[model samples]
Target: MSLPPDIADLLAPKYGLDPSICTGPGLVAATRLRMEINGLDDEFSYYDQLRQSGEELDAFVEELLIPESWFFRDRVPFDFLKSWVTESWLPTAKPEVDVLRVLSLPCAAGQEPYSIAITLLEAGLRPEQFSILSGDLSPRFVEQAREGTYRSIAFRGEDYVEREKYFEDIGEGLIRVRSFVRNLVSFKSMNLVCAEDYADDGPFQLIFCRNVLIYFNDDARRMAFEGLERSLTDDGVLFAGHADAIFRINDDFGRYGPPGAFCYSRRAKSETEDVPDALPKPQSKPLPAIEKRRRFFQTSKVAELPKSKDPVRLPSADSLTEAKRLADSGQLEDAERICRERIDTGPASADACFLLGEILLARKEVADADAQFRRTVYLDKSHRDALFRLALLAEQRGDSREAGNWRRRAANRAQPSTSMTNSPST
Candidate 1:
């Protein structure tokens, strides 16, 4: 059986889980299994117990949101961390301020924050020169993070080299992080959707929130980013997952470097921050159910998103190529319009659908983009780009099985004639 609608509705406000994850069969089976293990009579009983019992709720969230991560899970972020500290942070270090504060929100057991600690040390900073705060929604995860023990699977590639220096072999393929590394970090349980919980923990110089926001629905994302924005210092850099570009809607930050950097710095205060496309219109109609529920949890009203610039008509060209050009130029609405027109006027084209999907993603309309990509694959099963996109979207939403299936399909369809040899591993 699937997660019940009432239980799913409780998730976003209570635990910050995206309701869309409920549509997958994995969560359904997991919830049913949990209920049986708990000896609950029915879904309603499970819901009642969850609401009344904090332990049960935490356990349920843990079971549903099982994390998959490792030391230096993505090497780019850690490499950038070391570079940023060496090039950017050290030059401006204040004589009176000896300690650099960093945070890894939803630190996912302990790897990410520990990775940050190790990177800072590698950058020649002593443990006393920096402090790290890590948090996750799961109490179990927080406790495990505090324990600082991991199986060999937590080390990937050359990561074991660092592990050897910092971790003691505890036998049975387990390793424990040394006291020096563990001393630099403090771990706790937190729900990012509750912005007020960490309101005073602010002004972190560097925040690593990678691969996190993609799991939240729109309102939850806004709430979480609000907290992140408030917590970061004016000159601080925020490193996030490439897929977590939803924060761009607020304009409080600007891309710090190249697109692949996945890093952002707060825009200067003199610049106006605009919210665009994510807000609802005047109440001529009822708001979406998710929007209505979202509004109920907000402590203040959010500004309406700014309207897009008017599309300038251009000379007709090859429709697909023109759309690509427009999208590349950041004229997303115009690109989207061309793609839609092609779909509406001509026979269904997988290329058009795929391009439309890309346009929607650029606009941060994730659900719509997912639908378009699904349509593209339906039209042409061998469309590798669409398959790859579906895999990423599935993984972002915590559907590992679907992600693996889509990735395998994408690999099978890779063309031998293409110059690219092997696909990059995530």
Candidate 2:
């Protein structure tokens, strides 16, 4: 049996939430909660309230969107992404001024975008050379993505060592993203259904819309694909979910790799006729330049991080503070230069090496940055960022054993380091 027509119609069009899969009891339970909150007992009354108030609908949408994402959820696409960036992307890029723009729509609780940032970092692209723009239909998820923190469950299948690399265990099992990875990604609230949301934003180098299309009806899927097509650059690639391979539907994209990978490259427009959409497309135009948000998403900008009163602090920090300031201020060259100077003037410094590694990362210099990060861990075995970067580098290169080893090492070091002072014979 299907949902009552009104509820089904209301949900399907706006959010592409298929009634068939979402099932019955789940909808009833969720709707019941809304009814209780609004003091409406009847289903139709609640549906009326949903129709009358936009806020209620948004909240309902949030309830419907269960974000089930993990870093590199299925490893193949990222492996493909790493290969594409190195083999296809970098060679064609104007690295000096043209930043590699990537978009992750529905950046639920931020895993995908953060994964993108970390993956790109692992690939050794400098922060300045790439920028990740993440958006979600739920403002709440968008805010969460901005904060860049996660619980241990977020890293469940992953090695603990890998977790130690990008996150700091503030307390409990919660972890916060390091500034290096966080800096590369920007989060915004967007409705993929509303074509206006992304009209002005991109013709991105890469776009990830994984696992979302499964919920959409045929027409909604077509609309989503069309919108993606609009934002994707002629040479850009789209990363999709495995279960719903995009190749089955569209003539617009040529399958880039093996089945289950879900990566596709846009066909030359001339080679393919404009793919027909069941639904009418939204008219898109550029928005005013002034409306664009240029500032980095700090705690205040979006402010929905899982709050920790007692944050864990690591030692061996020095010019990194200033270097970070320079980098954030867009003085990347100066940041790199000063970090190098710090390394030169200092005694075998792991902090400086890590900083240089980060600087090199923002520059998209992967191999060099990998070397620096490796040296960092050598100089100071407890350097978590370096350890994590090494893991990412290994993972990208398909070295699961090395990645696992580094992850294990990072996990070991994440525990509070104990100090032993030399004393006169006890």
lDDT (10s digit) by residue, model 2, range 257-330: 43235666644334323322111111123221322322221112322212223322222355667776777666
Misplaced by over 4 Å in model 2 are 36-45, 268-426
lDDT of 2: 0.66
Each candidate: what lDDT? Answer: 0.69, 0.66
Say which candidate scores most in lDDT: 1
How does candidate 1 fare on TM-score?
0.65
Question: Which candidate number has the best TM-score?
Answer: 1
Q: Candidate 2, residue 240: CA error in Å?
A: 0.5
**Residue 381, candidate 1: how far off, in angstroms?**
18
